[model samples]
Target: MPNTPTTYPAGLSRREVVAWRNGIFTIFALCGIGIASWMARTPAVKAALDVSTAEMGILIFAIAIGSILGLLLSSHLLARFGAIAVMSACFVVAPVGLVVAGLAVTLGQLYWVAFAGLAIFGVGMATCDVAMNLSGAVNERILGRTIMPVFHAFFSFGTMIGAGLGALAELLHVSIALQAGIVSAVMFAVGLLAVRMTQSETVLHVPDETDAAAPDGWRSRLAIWKDPRTLLIGLIVLGMAFAEGSANDWLSLAAVEGHGVDRPTGAVVFGIFVTAMTLGRLTGPRVLDRYGRVPVLRASAVLAALGLLIFIFVPVLWIAIVGVVLWGLGSALGFPTGMSAAADDPRTAAARVSAVATIGYCAFLVGPPLIGFLGEHFGLLHALLLVLVLIVVAGVASGSARDRTKTL
Candidate 1:
């Protein structure tokens, strides 16, 4: 049986709960905006650095390495400093790194500067990612409802906005450094409001019973990696991360280099994908509530696989757009849903989420460099065929996401 929290902190007014929820949503959105802003400008960054596809992959890999390091450390950090403090610190760090990355492209030692900036950005993002998700999981227990997907939906909305702005900036010939600096300033200002709202909540004092029973120190944290179900859940999320991360990191590049679209047009295509994902997440909760996790996830995997095949095989532009929509909808639910499944037991939620996220993030580590190498040989469109196989693996593991009671 899961160790659900027995009680919430007492005497929170409904309004206060709403404010806290909004804060979580805003933080998620800001993180998304920060990431998407960098992603949308990737082609420009690559151009500025004058790097080959394979070399660009190496630069991207640095970010993933830093992210993996951050994920490895996040559980310890959250336990020591608490989610609010970690999140606030990371929120500041991520945008600053982005600003540095933007400015780095203008330097003579472009590769080194870009690599350093991206590494910092990745660490900040990985840490902030865990903190926000943990907060969302805690809030879900208090609300007695599934709100995780909604929070992720806000992230997609932010991506849409970021991508749109990036497309406009590309069209206007704005310098990447100036664009990133401007976005960073806005994110920092709004992030302050998000931090203030989350800080006003008094619920952090309530502790889950599982945390009490679980052994202290690294043993309890290390133990999560041994759970068969948790590992399976991690694989399921790994598939989703590959499907989504590939798009974030490579979609525009593929569109431009493979399909011969202009940069602004490629950004627009990326925007379409984020918009479709936003729609999926906005509506996923009702479907998940009625159908449950396994069925919805299995269906999503199949849909995503189909979309990948269509997008890769079809040469027509409009048809590819349709495929992008399907791909986005199909990939939207898996990551957040996996996070919810990992957090089913509140006591070990932080550790379990960190493990799952760490495993899932391997996709980022592997996908970009692999795609870049394959794109060097097979072409970007053909390289994407790799994701279809991962999607199939995810479908087989979807059952791991079933409610514990149902599986029992």
Candidate 2:
């Protein structure tokens, strides 16, 4: 981190504004498709490769590693190269990764392809997320009203489409390879379409400046660590990310394992979860505006805890639906709000947020497989219990963050 006097103009070039907005949605749409399809067909994939839960857990790491690589480097890379170039490039790789994963056979290959695809997917997502947040915050500064949550609605919509598409593909018995090719082609097309919308240049860049890289330097990120409030916010975000990760990756397995739901039905539970989450997010801004992100988070945490408790103790499949919905709604705001809390400012806020987010989402990358492994050895019910404990930690993070976010 060398800060490059990062600031957007009083107004962007019309082209930049259009490009940023459109590109953000484009990536979100693609991600929703990939994630939904994966979740929906988790059992099929597992069966095809003859993977036990532990093996599946190991394979999920590929996704996490890619996410870590993407987030940790995205800041400096974008700062050095600019947003559109990075975003467009990452988006292009997303589908290619999907195709590779679809064709993977051995557990090792699944891990490689899934992680590689997810990494590119993660990179594409990170790029879009950061750019829009940066752009949205800039818009808020210039226009003086909130617009982020609404923009995020598109992401929710994308998730819905992705999940639906996945379920449909599965019902049709589309080969994973063929379905993935479909996904990849779509992603590529979207990326190519998106490229036309990006700002060829940025206001955030420092002109006539050739920047030198630091070798042993963690100095840029180090600044955030030294600030107690910043450190706390980062931890809070990490907790939230962890909680959300468990929910996204494990909820289906929990339903299947703990409640004895069939594979197809269990996968659909995750769709229900995402659907509830997307609905919550789409409506969350109104609530956040009326009260605040912190209160919303605390309530969400308690709600999520209750949901998990239901999944564990209830034992009836019919009753578990309510629990999953509660879980979904509970989780909806944690990640996004945590990101907002981390950034919430102009200067280095974006970098700090991304850094915190990188650390936070690593939980998502690492958590699922670990849970899967734990479930393999112990039992999924026990894994769900562990997640409940983490949810409590996430709630605490949310409460701790409220004061700091206000300052930011």
Best by lDDT: 1
Q: Write the per-residue lDDT of candidate 1 for residues 336-376, one digit (tens) a residue.
A: 99988987776577788899999998897888779888999
Across 1-408, the per-residue lDDT of candidate 2 in tens digits comes to 112223346466555565565665565556666666666677777788777887775665565556666777767665566556666676676666667778774234455556466556656666556654554444433333334555555667766777677778878988777887887787778766765564433344333222214442345544555666566666666665666678777777788888888889988888788778778877876777677767888888898889878877898877788988898888777766666666554445556666666666667766766887889998887877777777787777665456342474
- lDDT (CA) per prediction: 0.83, 0.66
Candidate 2 ranges with C-alpha deviation above 4 Å:
1-9, 12-22, 38-59, 99-143, 147-153, 167-178, 195-218, 260-268, 315-319, 376-378, 399-408
- Please list all clashing residue pairs in model 1, or write none if there are none: none
- Once fitted onto the true fold, the runs of candidate 1 whose alpha carbons sit more than 4 angstroms away are 1-9, 43-56, 106-111, 168-175, 199-216, 250-271, 312-322, 375-382, 405-408
Q: What lDDT does candidate 2 reach at residue 100?
A: 75
Question: At residue 232, what lDDT does model 1 achieve?
Answer: 97
Candidate that would win on TM-score: 1
